[model samples]
Target: MTKKVVYLHGFASSSQSEKAVLTSAFFARYYPHIDYAALDLPYAPDAALALIRQHIGQTTEVALIGSSLGGFLATCIAEQLGCRACLINPAVAPHKVLHQHLGRYYHPVLQQHYEVTAEHMSVLEQLMPMTLKQPQNYLLLLQSGDEVLDYRLALDYYQGASIKLSEGGDHSYVGFAAELETIANFCQLA
Candidate 1:
């Protein structure tokens, strides 16, 4: 059976993120037969979860690829749905870290200032029951020089999962085409 891959972007990011776009294009060339879906999560975690659940419910074999906050969501969904996932620069402690961003902020692409509140932090905590679980089902891709998030936190959280830590790469981990192949291989797509 062909496995379906779902790509989820980070907070304030969309399906149009450079990684997402490049992933689509790369897969189109390397794994054209595999089905892929990229969702624009915006800032609605519950809505994104619902859409992901609906999509996964329709498939038997599936893989998820998520970046940053989306990685946190992907881990939640992977646990709930019993699927495998690839997490790239995932936010292991988003609730705590996001305390610095507790205010309304504008997204240039979305063209709106969205509210960031303690309630959202509560929701994030509720969504992430623990930092990590079922490590065997996960492949974590981390960069050591991520300026936004502390990569060591992810390393510690995903201790038992397969990990690839690259030096000098930022949070976005751009210009790593070979890393995509590694991720694909880990997801058993290669």
Candidate 2:
């Protein structure tokens, strides 16, 4: 079956991110039949969820690919929509981490500035899935040497899910291109 894949970038990142671009390019080169959506999501949690849900509702066979903060959001979406997800060093408790950067920040690639406020954080708290209902519905790809988020957090949180733990790599998830085919295969039905 032709599968649909949604690629969600990190907090400060966008659809134009290196990972997003490579994901898109990979499907374009190999799996041309797939449907893909990678947007420059708004910082607000509600807005981000709305955008994700809209695209996902359009397809029955859907999978989510999220990185960092995007990984956090994907988990929420996956539970609600009953779709499978692949998290790239996803954040288990972004509220705790985001609180550290609750102010104006800039996205160099998008060339836009935004703020992370307490109100914005409240939305994040509301959306966080207290428990993953279907642990089998996920594929967690983590790098131990990540400086931004502890890989152990994801390893613990997604305990029952399929996890690929690498030795030493940064939060950006080096060598992501080599795994696109597997990601595509996971998103489809047998």
Candidate 3:
């Protein structure tokens, strides 16, 4: 059977992320039988989830690979869709983290400066249900030295899920390709 895989990137990231690009290439070459999609999410979580739900609703079996904020979004989607997910350096509490992001920043790709606001943070919080209902459906990948988020938060939040901890890597997980096999295995594609 052909497997469906969707990759969702973090905030300020896009479908063109190095990890997404490499993973797409790897699957294209080695697992030609599988289907893949890389999502470029909107700045808002609701819009992103809508797009994800639409795509997932079309497939009978699916696997999700999400990074950072995308990972938090992925977990919510997986719960609703009953699909499996691989979360890489996921943000466990994005609403709280956004406090530090309340300023304007330029997006290199979009060539625009965007401000993080309280409303945006509230929207994120509203989208996330208080508790993770289906922890068993997720595989958490954490790096001890993530500069952006506290890895311990994810470790504790997803304590029930399968976890892979790397000793010293940043939030981007410096070398994500090495985890492709683990991701595939977790998704039951390996």
lDDT for residue 185 in candidate 3, whole number 0-100: 80
Evaluate model 1: give its lDDT. Answer: 0.82
Error of 2 at 173 (Å): 0.8
Give TM-scores for every candidate, taking all chains together and pairing residue i with residue i.
0.89, 0.93, 0.90
lDDT per residue as tens, model 2, 39-149: 777787888889888777766578889999999999998897778999999998888888887889887766878778998888888888888999998998899989999
Q: Candidate 2 — worst ten consecutive residues by lDDT sum? A: 181-190
TM-score (C-alpha, index-matched) for candidate 3:
0.90
Clashes of each: 0, 0, 0
**Model 2 TM-score (2 dp):** 0.93
Which residue runs of candidate 1 sit more than 4 Å off their true CA positions? 105-113
Scored by Cα lDDT, where does model 2 land? 0.85
Model 3 ranges off by over 4 Å: 103-115
By lDDT rank, best first, the candidates go: 2, 3, 1
The Cα RMSD in angstroms, rounded to one decimal, for candidate 2 relative to the true structure is 1.7
